[model samples]
Target: MALQRKDQDILNAMSLVESTKGELQKLRDNGWDSLMNKVSSFCEKHNAEMLVMEDVFVDPRKPRRKTNITNLHHYKVNCFYTILDLQLQEFNDRFTEVNTDLLICMASLSPLDSFCEFDKEKLVKLVKFYPDDFSYGETLCFEQHLDIYIDNVRRDERFKNLKSLGDLSCLMVKTQKHLAHPLVYRLLKMVLTLPVATASVERCFSAMKLVKTTTRNRIGDQFLSDCLVCYIEKELLDSVTNEKVIERFQMLNERRVVL
Candidate 1:
């Protein structure tokens, strides 16, 4: 939910992920007693029978094995530890070392809080990921530009108290600062395109369900792509008027009739 906020940025998102991992680890290590107490309270309130920790745990469907196991082992090891371990593993799998570093590097470029998070070293490292976007010559130039860009934006009143990357990008363009620091703006553009969370992807899938219904199941890939683009980017599409679209369509080929 923190990651899904409208104003959430890469810096905040990265911090949230890191903090969540730490909290989950702490739970796995020291939360058993606390968790058990809550569960016990809930069970007692609901009139559910609470099993004795020392009692032998019996498998309802399977035949009893020769080896004895207490309810403590069954719940603590198989249920508690197992679930926590799986969650920690999932976090590790999703936010691997490289991915975490990438996020950190990207966060360094954030314009929030007067660009307090800006790090020239991380920005340089970030560009390496996209060699196609930042060539050898451009990369060197970007390092030089970063020094000037950071200094300028930090001192500039227009860049102060910025909320998100989108605001920074817009302000840069509005002030014509993007033209002054082309490489920095280019890197910013690339960073903006990277997906920090699954919210947009989930929205796309939800929109797809509505778009490609049974009646429209046979739609071609190209047509589907066009429809999805317009549907997903409705805000941008809304600005365009029917007459403007007709004018552009007519301009595509010379029309015989003026009307």
Candidate 2:
């Protein structure tokens, strides 16, 4: 509760949320197979006979004939496995090849290994990923500058113990080489802003779900946007005093602030 709303603090909050969510998600990922097998065993205990199941979307329905009762468990098991299969398919559909490549490139930017990500090829791939964002000459220049930048900085005592991407960016800005390596700096800026914005946006959506549940779903867009801005930027909100609010409110009405 006392944490400042610094970028790293916000990131740490999001990371903690992610760590907990990930621990729970392992049950959904790796536990599914075993859990489904256990469900199959339960069906077997209920006299479900093994039958080859085909992948088809069929809702559970009452059997029309006596003979169909024998295959009831088959349908149930098929439905469960079919759902698991579809979930895996959906996961694949969401995390496409390009997204995976970009994530790998992001990992390479980590500074813990003494800024070891001086790889021209991986960074070239990163720049190439957003071809529209980089001019061809800038891309080539960045590709060349990467090696020079690391070699120029790595052996220096100041850069030896760096830990995170933010630390590296600060060092670069402190040294004022971000001007010299604009493209790389741009990429670093994107890397810094993207995840933080993504986390904040995701949290805002979750807050919106709470605020605008089905019963309250008619919230006006302007009100909703205003709520989100305040909610997402609560640290700033905390710093604002009630007198200031009253002052602003009175100014709107041309009266003394009552607070």
Candidate 3:
């Protein structure tokens, strides 16, 4: 019966935990109780009726006593969760509802490293999901479709006399005058706009590491937070309202002597 098979699957998954009891016990001994609890909770909540063992491999390296390193063994357990067909459909529909033009623009502006790794098939899928929104009118929807857009543009007498980026910009400016939906116009503006890179966040962390080196590792968490906030948000620090400054000074003065 289907019910029996589902029950068997759950049992098989639980058996994997039982087989790893020794490792799990070691983890508990090492103060990983919270992690163990989370894994147990995930299994309980997911209704993972079937668990299948994947690949298992053992390291050929000899154990090192000084480093407390032992032979490594890796194993994986696969589990499945059931979802209703309607739920899946609803999820797919929501993503499909996003405007194609906006999606393409966002995708174009996404980190180069992230977008470069996507395959042609994935790109096609994305385009298909939001076909109506993209400005494939100016350029081909896909590299393969480039000729289509080019032919369309070439045949249009309005664009026949236009050439170069300046001409394209002028056309775009003229077209904006007739936009019916303000939301679409705003979305287009956002997609065309370049996003500022967050290299400063990385720089801030590097500065924090330099400031809190081995010698200062014992620094209190609160003090370290205050120091970093002041250093990183120096501009905002200068703009602190007079009322806040007065309240802070009053609190500090009350804690000690008035100067």
Candidate 4:
């Protein structure tokens, strides 16, 4: 969000606009090569130590007595390349050509760094990218808003140092100035709603340890979901004492049990 995506796009476009994708691909290829080289160096440095298997001195036919039966080869091929391949596939899937362009355009609405990095051209591309979402009049009106928004944001200290799009949305609401930049604020709201990262969702998996286990793995999906909700919000659950919990359980269907 702090990047000048418009300027970067324009700078890339300077060398024949059609070549930008090619250049980006080249950079990706170079990055992949660099990663492979690093992995190769690490493997070479530790090949003997990592790939060596323990000696098994007995034949399979004689393994009925004291013997170490082993089928693993000493020359183990690491699956680091497979991991890199999957990561590349995931990246390509999520960041198709059109999606990359859309994201670059969306960066125009970012409120980080006092809005000094906002670009009208990228904002215009964003409007054009989704014609149905934004009308012609609204996009045209955005030009006026863009200038006023930059001036207003630069002058106002309240708009500075926003950590994320969520912060930006809250600042917009707090200032009560959505009317000043309706299109930008709308885009801001949309960006705020986007699931940029899965850290919050990923945290739930850590919380899952509290409920699901080998001995109690028959939890239904709905029940597991309820458990996760409770697990994730432990601070609130901690506030409810044993008495309150017992009361709630007793209240379920006319006193189900006494805790």
Candidate 5:
């Protein structure tokens, strides 16, 4: 049964690759030959065979033009989605296999990182999910009187013997007290505890607000999205420079003038 399940898994993975043939071909044509070799090597290492149908051997006629923008876009989107799907699957598999105790520790420590967005409800749900591995009162709070929760836990004799939890609680209390500015302390606590390390979400929102304000209230959603992307990703926007912006503005002005 185990071998059969493994074979089925392999078949499913192969099906995913087969379904993305157009994408694979585009990658091959666009100097992504290394990616094609990696995919082939992955299949070979896993003892999987590509079951190519008759239609797979036939290539459709290429467009007469030297450039193929539509095909390029389609290929890029397909490849991106396929890779993202595989990564998410692997992440889910690994998450499910994590030890409950370690997961609790992660939950406890996660809030200290600057990148970790604190969600008390999610943490409560996580605690409930692994009740046997973690006691509800074991959590030490960094702010908003979380120390009270820790105090309540420490008062219980049953938890007093757990040196690690006691030590962590003590350290948290010391850190909270010594950190002078409350805001800085909170941010530092978040940075130290959470697994997330980046402020990209905050940065994105900042950029979005800069682009989409009351002055541009009438902007279309698609245009707003493009603007946000261009603003947030400066390297991509470099190709569409001041000249392009001026040209677009002039075109719009001419159209309005004629109307």
Candidate 6:
């Protein structure tokens, strides 16, 4: 849900990532008893038989073998801990130390809260990662520009109400500050184009799942593509009238009767 925010919340990405990891760890450490209690309550409410944790748990697939593991051991160790470990592993793989550092540096460039997160050193460090984009002299120039840009933007009334990096970029161009501070604007443009906005991409995948369900699994590529476009861009779809849709369908082929 945090990833679904329009603001992107880049400034809090690092903290969010860290806190998520912490929560997962906490769950793995002490969540078993709490989980069991919930399961107990659910089973009781449903009038379902509860398993005795102390009872021997036999492997259903290998009943011939002598199995001595308790139901508690099978559920807690094989299922709960294993699932949490896999989740932690995936999280570690996705958000490496380098990725975390880059996100933190990117957050420093956020224009939200009147550029409260603005940091010259971090921005300079961020540019270093894209050596192809910023040469040594250009990097030094960007570092210098940060000093002037942050000071001017923070004091400028136009920038005070900025809610996002996109807003900041447009305001920079609108106020002709981009011309004076081309490098800073260039960095802002770079930041805007970064794939750090995974929320939108995640949302696209989610929309795809809704558009292409099990019943529609065999749908043609073109039809699925059209469905996804309408599903994902609902705001644009809302503007389209039913008459306009019928007109478009009529235009596509000669029907038995034209409406």
lDDT of 6 by residue, 1-259 (tens): 7856765566576678789899999999999999999999999999999999999998889988877789999999999999999999988998888777777787887777888788888888888988998888998778778888889888888888887778888888999999988888888788777655488877888888888899988999999988889888888899999999999989998889997
Please write out the lDDT profile of model 2 over residues 101-181, one tens digit for every residue.
Answer: 665677566676686655668778888877778888888787777877767667677878887778889998998878877
**Candidate 2 ranges beyond 4 A from true positions:** 1-60, 65-78, 196-201, 208-259
Task: Kindly list the per-residue Cα lDDT of model 4 for residues 180-207, writing each as its tens digit.
Answer: 7778787776655444433455577778
User: What shift in Å separates residue 82 of candidate 3 from its native position after superposition?
Assistant: 54
lDDT score of model 3?
A: 0.44
- Point out the worst 10-residue segment of candidate 5 by lDDT: 2-11
Candidate 6 deviant stretches above 4 angstroms: 33-55, 205-233, 236-259
**Is candidate 2 or 3 superior in TM-score?**
2
Model 5 per-residue lDDT at 235: 69
TM-score, one value per model:
0.71, 0.56, 0.25, 0.51, 0.22, 0.71
Clashing pairs in 6: none
lDDT of every model, 2 decimals = 0.86, 0.67, 0.44, 0.64, 0.47, 0.85
Candidate 1: misplaced stretches above 4 Å? Answer: 42-48, 63-67, 112-116, 131-141, 151-182, 220-259
Candidate 2 residue pairs in backbone clash: none
Ranking by TM-score: 6, 1, 2, 4, 3, 5
Q: Which residue pairs of candidate 3 clash?
A: 9-49, 9-50, 10-49, 101-133, 101-134
